[model samples]
Every structure is written in structure tokens, then in C-alpha cells.
Target: MDFKYDVIVIGAGHAGCEAAVAAANLGSKTCLITMDMNKVAQMSCNPAVGGIAKGQIVREIDALGGYMGLITDKTAIQFRLLNRSKGPAMWSPRAQCDRNKFIWAWREVLENTPNLSIWQDTVKEIIVENGEIIGLTTFWDVTFYAKCVVITAGTFLNGLMHVGKTQLPGGRMAEPPSLQLTESIVKNGIRSGRMKTGTPVRIDGRSVDFELMSTQDGENDFHKFSFMNDGTQHLKQLQCWTCYTNEEVHQVLREGLAESPLFNGQIQSIGPRYCPSIETKIVTFPDKEQHQLFLEPEGETTQELYLNGFSSSLPLEIQIAALKKIPAFRNLEIYRPGYAIEYDFFDPTQLKHSLESKVIKNLFFAGQVNGTTGYEEAGGQGLIAGINAHINCHGGEPFVLARDEAYIGVLIDDLVTKGVDEPYRMFTSRAEYRILLRMDDADMRLTEKAWKLGLVKEDRYELMKSKREAIKRIIEFTKDYSIKTALINDALEFLGTTPMKYGCKLIDLINRPQITIDNIANYVPAFKQMLDEIEENRKEEIIEAAEIQIKYQGYIERERMIANKLARLETIKIRGKFDYDSIHSLSTEARQKLIKVDPETIAQASRIPGVSPSDINVLLVLSGR
Candidate 1:
């Protein structure tokens, strides 16, 4: 039998779900094919989403009309604003979700999404003609045709899970691996490589000694993953328990290192350096006496608690012995032992900034397929790929984001420019313009673009406009409103900030470290009155946005200037026009990298690994700049 679609997404992981939804919402007939329907958007590794730089990415995804942030908010069992003591730029929102609910939420969205169809089948081959993707063939002997295809196969492609010496063929535990798909694409000129990642064991919560561990409670403030969702608790909130692994635990792990698949020659693929296994941690940090671990609930009703920071592929008996060393886990009864997964990932450098393949037209890759580790990173890439896929079906300019514009931009650009030697994960330090990519203003930065593409609904676009206007009003008011010394001096003294000798602009007081809008409002009647006029639904968000703008105005302006200066090079298009191999003035490495990347702009070309400033000067000379 034959099927046709405008875009075919080959997996139902975070990336595939976002891609299919985005494309279909944009009016394209999109088909999402997965090996299993029950595991849609499976939290195979962890039940939590958004952390550090990843939270910012999820907010950006939300701003772009993707469903990850919304779904996370709906199913989240606990929400915490990470890095609260840091500057606003460093503030990130994280949530521990109900694992089962997360899957159900995504599945419900996919099933109800217009113009999208879900099929339970594994793709065996990708059909291509004249150097462009036509569609794919599933294992069930059904052929599907499309103008474009997004491969979010994740770790499913040639997946191999290892628990010590025992190995299993599965995408996830108990799920079979996807076969033939990797080889089918690799033989078609795209490059492929292997990566390894692992998850910690799940514990029976009833057996855990909560009295021995530190209790980490979720925040009850007005903070959530999605801007559209009000901060309401639908599910029962749960507290995560934190414990430490002692010298005894480390010694047991050390003894089992020889039997570990990661240590042995059984697994050769590179794993995430940032989130290493327990065995790797001990080996890397031999001097540290203890390592911290968090016992997080997988769901509110389920007693299966995920053991964070204890990921390993050590022998099952050794794992059990190590857990017994901790007072809290002395009676640890586990659902399953921790295991490391080795799977195939394609070289992301083989793709364009839009995630489209350079060699194969209308072919895109996202998620683990692009050698990225986190769900937020995968969702961002998927959204871009989905939008581009829709644009590919109907003639339009390709969609791309700048490094300064969004974290998603930095991720894709880094992937295509530097490529990956190991599994790539998002970090706050990775983005050069993070000051401009704060979690607070994701909607301000990207919603208009999403609205222009018809990916965002009218109500959402209106909300963005209202929020923008409200923030502007607050900033403008603070810029003009001067306070009296008599009224605020005592309040300032109470807040522990220096009392003003004379009257100053409202923003001047807010710029002080100890003073916050919430705290200082008691002294400033005019400011409080203005804030009170706002609708209750969006009042806090508007006030926070305004306060951040006022407090970091100087930093924000400076970063914008730097971003604007760097953005000039982005305007110089050289993607298809460059013939670096024919230019003798360029270095050989520069020529090779330039030819390989074929960057869309001079800015992008400047970022490619082997391309130096001298090579960029040569390109400028050739381009008549």
C-alpha cells in the first residue's frame, strides 16, 4: 500500500512530535511514524525537563508555538525556578514531570492536531530520487511519499543497551531497536557515527529512608514552563530527596569498574561528558569523597523513583551493594538496574542551519540523530525543521535563527559549524549573547517571527503584543517617575540598600541589588497604583519583565550593541555562491571546512572550525565587501 504526505516524520520522540505538529499546524499534511504509539515523547532517561540553558530553550520553543513548554507545564508535578540567587539572565525554570502524563499529553496533542496522522511502524528505508528525499518505506511493507522527511530517530537507530556484560537490542528498555534505517541513510552519502548515553536505576519509594535525605521542595510562586498556562497545580506536588554517595559506595563502584561495559572494550562510543555515569565519575574525580544524588519521583501515583547522578552500566550486584552504602538507600529495592545505551547518530555538520541535509534536498535531522543530548535541544531543532519542512512543501524563504536571537540558533549553528566529537548538550556558557536570550523574554524575542510564519495562533500573538506593551509601559514609567527622599529613604533603609540623599528616577532605586519591585512597592504609591491597574492574569509577569528591564538596562543595551555589530556579517550571504576549492588564496583546511559547511552567511562561515580570520578576509575580498 502507498501513502502520501507533505512531510513525513520518522519517530515520535520529542523531536518527531514537535516536527510533525509544527508542520501540520502550518497546513501541511504531515505523517508521524513511530515503532510504538504508547511511548510517544518517552522520558527514557529522566522525568524532568528544563535546566540551566535548557530551560531557556524550552521557553524559546514555547515562544515559537511549539508544544513542549505547554505540555511540560500541563503535566509537571513540580516546578522550580533554577538559579534564583543569580542575575535574571542566569535564572532558568525547571520542572519535574509525571513521566506517564508527559507521554499521554504529547500523544493527545498529536492525535488531536489537525493535518497530522500517526502510524505505528518502523521505517526500514528512505526513498530518494535525483539527490532529493521522496519519502520512506516502513518495516510493514508500506511506502509513504512526501516532499520532505524529518528523521528524529533518536537512539532507536541501531540501539544497543548494556547492563554490565549483558547487552540488549532496544531503543529503550523493553522496546525493540530500529533496524536498517541508519544503514539505509548512510549509504546515501550522509555521514553517521555512534554515541553512548545512560540512565540511572529506578527505586521503590516505599523502601527509601526519607528521614536521612535532604528534602528539596518545589516553588509555589508564579513560575511555569509555558507563558500561555496559568500557574495552577493540577497534579499532587512531590518533593525530591537528595543524598550523597560515600567512600564505601565509591569503593564498590571502583571494584566493579573492571566489569563495567563502559570501562571494558564492550562499548567504544563516546557518551555525554557533562552527564557521565557513576563509574566514570569515580574514575574522573578520585579525590572527591562523596557524590550527590537526587531521588526524584517518576510519577505522583507510582512509587518508581529515579535515582539521578547514579547512572552506570556496572554489574547489577555491584549496583545494589553501592546503594546499600547510603543510609537513605540501605533498603533500596530497584525496578531496574542502570544501563548505558549506545546508538547511531549522524554528523550534524552534514546539515544546514535549518536542519536540512546539504547533500539530500528536503531531508532533515533533529534530536539525538544530530548528536544532541537533551529534550529541549531536540525540540528546538525539531520546531525549526518542521517549519522549514512546511516551507519546503510550499515555496517560501527558509527559516533560520541567529546565535544572538535564540539558544536554538546557537545550537544549530554550533552543530553545523564545529560539529560534535561527543554528545552535544546545551550550556549557558555556550551562547555568546545569553544576556539577550533570558528565559523571561523568550516571547518578546521570537513570538513575532512565529506569528509571521502562521505557526502561532492569533490569541498568542495578541498576548505577546500585550505583554510587550505592558513591559514597555512599566519601563517608560520608571524612566520618568522620580521618587521623593522623604517617602523612600526609610523603605530603602529597611531593605538594606543605601538611602537616597535626594529624589531620583524610579529605575535608579530598582537598579540597586538589595531593592526589588516587590519590596520597594510599599514605599512608592505611584508605582503600586500603576501595577494594580494591570489585569491579574498577567500582572506579575508584566511587573517582572519591567523590573528586569529596568534593573539590567545597561547590560541589555551593551549586549544588544555587541550582537548588532556581529549581526552585520550575518547579512552577507555566501552559502551557494562560494567556491572555496577553486580559490588558491585560502588555506587547505579553510577550503575543506568551507566546502564542507557551505555556510549561509559570512558570520556562519566565520564560525566554522578550521576557517580563520585571514580566510574570512579572503572571502570578503572575493565577495567585493
Candidate 2:
């Protein structure tokens, strides 16, 4: 049988799901092919979504009309805003979700999406004709044709799972690996390498002693990810527990070193540095007495608990023995032992900024296939790839984000510019223009762009515009409104700040480190009256945004100026057909790297590792800049 689609997305993980949705939403006939329909958007590692930089990516995904944030909000069992005490730029919103519900939510959305369809089949080979992707052939000998293809195979391409000396051919724990796809792609001249990631053991929570652990609850206030007010609120929140692994636990785990695949040199790929296995942590930090472990609930309705921070590839017997040493886990009943899986990942440097393959026309890669570790990173890449695929197919201009614009931009830039030697993970520190790319205002930054691209819905777009106008009004009011000395002195004294002798604009008071809009609203009748006039639903968002804008006015302006200056380099486009090999004036290393990456702009070229300042100057001269 033959199936035809404008876009074909392989693998129904986070990346594939977003890619399919984005393409379909843009009116492209998209087919999402996965090995197992039941595992669509499955949380293979953890039940929770968003953390630190990952949380920011989720918001950006939502801002750009992606479904991840909305689905997460609908199924989230607990929500927390991380780094709230710090600056607004550092603030990130995270949600611990009901794993089953999260996947079902995604499935429901995809099923209802107008131009999208789901198929259960294992892809065997990408059908390339005349150096361009034309379609794919599945293992069952069924063929599907498409103008563009997105491969988000994740950790399933030639996957190998290890637990002690025992090894199995599996994508994750029980899922079968994609054996033929990686070989076919590699044979087609696309470079590939191996990287590993692991998941912790699942414990029967009913058997564990809660009294022996410290409880950590979610925030009391209501918060969500989608900007459109999805009406899905977390009515009853679940609490996570914390425990620690002592010297005894470490010693028992060390005893299994001889049989461990990681230590035995049976598994040789580099894993994530930030999320190290328990054995790696012990070996790396020998001086530490104990390591903290978070006992996360897999779902509110299930008794399974995800033992986070205890990811391992050790012997099953040793794992059980070590768990018996911890106080809270003394009577632990594990649902399954932890294991590490190593799989094929292409070097992301082979892709363009839009995630399209530089070697293969109409082929794109996202998620773990591109060497990124988190669901948020994968979803972000998937969205871009899907949009670009649709645009390319329909004769529209390709969409790309700048470094100063969004975290998604930083992620792609880092990958294509500097190739990863290990599993790549997003961090707030990675983005230089994070001050301007805060999670609080992602909708303001990307919704208009998404709307213009036909991705954002009209209702969501309208909400975003209204919110932006409200924030602007509040900021302008603060700039013009002044509080009298008599009215503000008591509030200032209460806040432990020196009382002002004269009247001052509200913006001036807001600029002070200790003062906030909420604080001023409590004492000033005029300010309170203005706030009262605004709708209750929008008041909190307006005040929060207004406060950040006022407090960091100078820093934000400086960053914008720097961003604008760097953005000029992006305007200098590099011709696609330009022959770098013919440019003899360029250095040998620069020529080789530039030829390999074939960067789209002077800004991107400048970021390439071996391309020096001298090389950039030569390019400028060659381009007659």
C-alpha cells in the first residue's frame, strides 16, 4: 500500500509529535509514523515536564502555538515556579504531570488535528531520489511518499540497553529498537555516532514508608503554562518525597563495578554530564558522603514511583541491596530495575539552523536524534523543523530564530555551530540574551511571529496582543504617576527602605531594589484604583511584567542594543552555491569547516569553531561588504 503526505514525521516521541502537529496545523497533510501507537508522546524517562531552562523552552513552544505546554497544564499534578527569588529572567515554571494523562492528552490533540493522521509502523529506509528525500519504506514493505521528512527516532535507532553484564536490543526498557533505519541513513552519507541516557528504577510507592522521608509540596497559588487560559487548573496537588543515599549505599553500588557495563568498558558512549548515573556520581565525587534522591510519583492514580537521581546500569541484585540501605527505601519494592540505553545520534553540525539536513534535501532531525537530552529541547526543535518543512513544501520562506530572540534559537545555534561531544542539554547560562527572553514574556516575543506564519490560533493571538497592551499601559502609567511623600512614607518605612522627602514617579520607586508594584498598590490609592480598574485575570500578569520592566530598565535596554548590533551580521547572507573551496585566501581549517557546515549567514559563520576573526574579514572582503 502507498500513502502520500506533504510531511512525514517518524517516531511519535516529543519531537515527532510537535513536528507532525506544527506541519498539520499549517495546513500540510502530515503523517506521524511510530512503531507503537500506544507509546505516542510517552515519557520514557520521567513523568515531569519543564525545569530551569527546559521550562523556558516549554513556554516558548506554547508561545509559538505548540501543544506541549497546553497538554502539560491539563495533566499536571503539581506546579512550581523555580528560581522565583532570583531575577525575572531566571524564573522558570515547572510541572510534574500524570504520565499516562500527558500522553493521552497529546494523542487526543493529534487525533483531533485537522490535517494530521497517525500510523503504526516501523520505518525501514528513507527513500531518496536524485539527492532528495521523496518518501520512506516501512518494515512491512509499505511505502509512504512525502515532500519532506522529519526523523525524531530518539533513543530507538540501533538502541542497546545495559543492566550489569546483561545487554538487550531495546529502545527503552521494553520497546524494540529500530535496527534498519540508522544503517540506511548512514549509508546515505549522513554521519552518525552513539550517546547514552538512563532512567531510574520504578518503585511500588504503597510499600515505601513516607514517614522516613521529607515531604515537598507544590505551590499554593495557581499557575499554568499556556497563555490562552486553558481553564485546566490543578485542584489537588501531589507531594514529592526526598531521601538520601549514604556511604553504605555507595559502597554496595561500588561492589557491582566489576559487572557494570559502564565500568567494564562494554558501554563506551558519553552520557549526560548534568544527569549522571548513581555509579558515575559515586566515582566522580568520591569525597561526598551522600547524594540526595528525589522520590517522584509517576501519577496521582498509580502506585509507581520514579526514583529520580538514582539512574543506574548496575546489577539487579546490587541495585536492590543498595536501596535497602536507605531509610525510606528500606522496605522498597521495585517495579523494575534501572538500566542505561545507548543509541545512535547524528552530529547536529550536519544540519542547518532550521534543523533541515545540509546533506539531504527535505530531511530534518530533532530530539535525541540531534543529541539533545530533554523533552523541551526536542519539542522546540520539532516545532521549528515541522514549520520549516511545511514552508519549504508550500513555497514559503524558511523560518529561523535569532540568538537574542528566544531560547530555542540559542539551542539550535549551539548545536549547528559547535558540534556536541556529549549529550546536549539546555541551560539558562547558554543564552546570552536571557534577560530579554524571560519566560514571563515568551508570548510577546514569538506569538506575533507564529501568528504571521499561520501557526498560532486567532483566539490565542488575540489574548497575547491584549496582554501585551495591558503590560504597556501599566508601564506607561507607572512612568507618569507620582506618589506624594505623605502617602508613601509609611509604606516605605514598613518595607525597611528610607522614606522619601519629596513626591516621586511610581517608576522611580519601582526601580528601587526593595520596592514592588504590589507593595506600592497597598498604600497608594491612585495606584490601587488603577489596578482595580483592570480585569482580575490580567492584573497579576500586568503587574509582574510592569515590575520587571521598571526594575531592569537600564540592563534590558543595554542588552537590546548589544543584540541589535550583533543582529547586523545576520543580515549578511551567504550564498548557498558559493564555493568555499575556490576561495584560496581563506585558511585551510576555516575553508574545511565552512564548507562542511555551509552556514546561512555571516553571523552563523562567525560562530563556527575554527573560523577565526581573520577568516571572517576575508569573507567580508570576498562578499564585497
Candidate 3:
């Protein structure tokens, strides 16, 4: 094996996988080293991918030539488009993936990817010389060299898991913690903090009472995470059962609170606010009758199920008692109890927009190690880090995505700009231009940039281009084509929406909330005929994308204009141009924060927590922009 490469990615979790694949595909010789070979892209928390803003991030990953979306599509057992009642901006594609198959699928891609190698080993110490990364030494005492290194250690860094009074040192269930890596990196003058995250108990399906729970079926549609998909479902479809926790369940959890690491002060780190433990949930919402839980299948053949929304760090027996209190789990058998793990995370503010360390050149950070909580967020960072690491090695302009351009961009900007007080999770509300960052248009927004960088394959790039062209045709046809009220009123009234009073362009009718290209096509045969001219494979997806653009054209354009206006602030370069402390007009807080953040542009400065709009104006005036 070669001892040297252009980039080496430590830890093969979602971030490492994307980083390694991205760098390698960009023609960089990349090596992805991990502690275990079988657990690549392991679904440590949940057996699902894409939710809320997370689904948008996954779509962006696919658009930018990352492997997560493709791997997820191949392993997904059940698929659903979340936020269906909402508009296009909130529509997120989620999939219940086969956990084991997900790992196998990711491994298959990593193994076969060009210019990439997978090595099973723990990275112990990163070798830095003169403030630049050179390589790293593994736990097995094997030394490897690289021009750039991305540390995506995840929760493995000094990992410690707790369930009731029992505490164990492990990354995941059985994996050993990477004990020295955090210390080694922290000594490099980078700030680090501890964060807590937990998972729910696995269940034996035979013990679950399906009759007592409401069935949540997956959506069968053309919507999927990756544009590269053949739009075919891979694994056999399965049903997920939804149940709720009653007061009886809460009483048992309350009784066990004395021993819960989260409450008893056994754990000091902060956990994810959005995915709080069952104990936290009960305590936080005392008046609520029940909290929802989903029983998701682990794989096609396995009876093992993941108990979502029941995450806990309470006693194992208490966890069982809580589940048994619920009618569905009356006869519940279990695989393993839920537990919380505390691990090391670096302050993301220490990293640049490219996810490279500000202090150490060419050394990058991604994933949970950057104080983020989900697979989607980690993969987005990995994709960017991998791209930048290659560029850092070979020399090019830093690739920074604006917040309006993508959810990935918003995530990185928030991380590098605001840092995190707790484990960060993405939500639709976080991105201001979410309307422009719709899930259906990830390819339209990002694929061409990736293609130009040589990260996107020609075939995929061509497909994206073809899809875009088809969508444009659909939009144009809708704009030009008109329909009489007599022809469309019956269909509209039948659908329980207002009937048109007069003739209108097809787009104007489709713009109505109740009207959709799919629904309207059924009534207007001519519109359906035009849609049929699109490629058969992605006909539905293209039509939907076109419809979204048409319906939200006004909102999308407004958001785009706002985003563009703010983007001009991005061009006013302020970094390294001012000694913020010397700028007397800037507030003391702004001065301190500006010096600390050292934002590259006035727009980034404005987003920093302590920097006010007035401070931004001061910087703008000082920068003569």
C-alpha cells in the first residue's frame, strides 16, 4: 500500500465516506481509514436518512457528486416525502434504510471508487509541521503520509456511553474508543468540547403488538434523494408502526430519573435539543398525554426494529418498563437497551467555510466532531471538506457555498460563523432562501459546478442537464398553454377546489394550491401529452420540479432577489483588512467577535452572533465598499 496520498480521511462514517469519495473523484489520490471495515456509513442513531432540512442537505450532497444519496437509494426499504402538506420548500424526502444493507452499499461504492483506498485502522495522531498537515499515525503504529488530512472522528474520540449506573468506553456498541486522537488534536491549540447523544432500544418484532399501533406506510412515488437513481425501489418495502407514550410510561421513566446520567449529573455535556431523551421529553412536556414513537425495521429479513423517539440514558430496566407500559410493547422482547454516549467535539468556529482548520493548514474537520448531530449534516461537511482538501493540496480558490445556494451552505456558514452551543441540527427555518433550495432542484442548483470541477461524472452531469432542459420545457409549455374554465372547472370542483371563473394560462391554474400538474393533467389531456414528451424514466420527477418552479415562481423570485441583494455584501472583502479593535465605531462585542471570527466578507461579519448591523456598516465603510 502507498504510504502517501493527496488526501487521507480518518474515520469512515458519513462524513469520511463523502470526503474520501469526493476527493478521489476530483482526481485526488485519497485514502479513507477507519477503525472498522464493516461499519462504513453506519447508521449509529437511526436506520433512516433525510428529514426536515436534513433531506434537503442529502439532496445537495447528491447534486454535488457525493455518494450518500446513491447509497441510500439502493438500501432504502421504505420511502416517504415528508412535509407533503407544505409547499415545495418544506417537502423533504425521507427513507427507512436497511441498516446493514446501507453499510454494504456504502462499502461497495468506496471500494470501487477511482483513486480511493479503504484501510481499517484508528488514526491516533495527526502529524503537523509548521502549521500545516503532513500525515497521521494509526493506532496499529503504521504511519501514512498525505498532503492534507480530514479528521471525521465522529463520537469515537474518547467515547463514553452510559445506561443507568453502568458506564462503558466505546465509540458505538462494541467498537473501542479512539482515546488519543482528541488529545492529540486538542494539543494543537484547537478548542474542543464534549457532547452527548443517545439512541433508542432495538426491539424484537415478534414481541411488538402490531394491532395496537397505527401503521405508517411509505410513499410510493418518483421522489427520491438522488437524481442518479434509476427511480426503482431496491429493498422490499416494509411498514413502520407508530405508537405513543402514555403517563404510565412517563411514571416509570420518572422513577428512574434518579439514575439517569442526563439528570443525575453523571454526564456534563449537552445533548441534542431536538432529539432529547425520553426522560427529558417527559420532564419538558409534563402536560402532554403522550409522545410519539416509531417502530422501524432494521432490515428486510431481520425482526429487529429500531424504537425511534424513545432515546434514553436512563436505567435499562426503566427503559423496558416504559416500553412495556405502552400497549404495543406489553410483551416486548429486546435486543439492547438505549444508552447515551459522550464524545469530544471541536468548536466548528475554529474551522473555515471549507471546513479546514483555521489554525492548522490543510487539516479539516467534519461530522459530529464539529458539534453537528445527523448523518446528512456530516455528509454535507464531508463533501465540502473533501473538495477543499484536494484544492488545498493542488492549489485553487476555496469552494464556499453561499447560504442561499444550498442547505449545505447554510449549515457550514452557521457552524463556522456562530459555532454551536449545543449539538446542531438543521431545520427548514434555518435557511432564509429555502424556497430556492428546494429538494427537487438540487441538481439544477449544484450539479454544473461539480461537473466543472470534475467531481461529477459525465453521465450524471448529462442526466442533470437533460432533466433541467425538460423542466424548462414544462415550465415554458405551462406558461404558453391556456385552458378554458369549461374544460378545467369540473376537474377543479371534483378535487374540492375553487372552479376557475375564466380562461387562464395552465401555469396560472397550476399556481393554485389545490391544482398540480399531476392532478390537472388528468383533466387536460393536451397538458398530459406535453409532459409525456419528457424522458420516461424521470417524467414524474421532472413534472413535479417544473410545477414547483411555476407555482412558487413569485415566492422563489422574491427569495432569490433578497439572497442576491445580501450576496453583494459577500463581495465586500473585509478579512485581514482591518484591526477590528482599532475600529472605534465598532461595539466592544463586535470588535471582540470580529477579531475572533475574522470573517472573509462583510456578509459573513453581519451573520456573526455579536456583530450588529451597525458594525457591518462600520466594516463596510472601513473597507471602502
For model 3, what is the error of residue 568's alpha carbon versus the real structure, in angstroms, after optimal superposition?
0.8
Quote model 1's TM-score: 0.98
lDDT of each: 0.92, 0.91, 0.91
Residue-wise C-alpha lDDT for candidate 3, range 175-219, written one tens digit per residue: 899988888888889999999999999999999889999999988
Residue 401 of model 2: what lDDT? Answer: 90
Between prediction 1 and prediction 3, the one with superior lDDT is: 1
TM-score of 3: 0.97
Q: What is the lDDT of candidate 3?
A: 0.91
Best by lDDT: 1
Off by over 4 Å in 2: 575-587
Task: Give one digit per residue, the lDDT tens place, for model 2 in 82-122.
Answer: 99899889989898899988888999998999999999999
**Which is the leading candidate under TM-score?**
1
In model 2, the Cα lDDT at residue 214 comes to 97
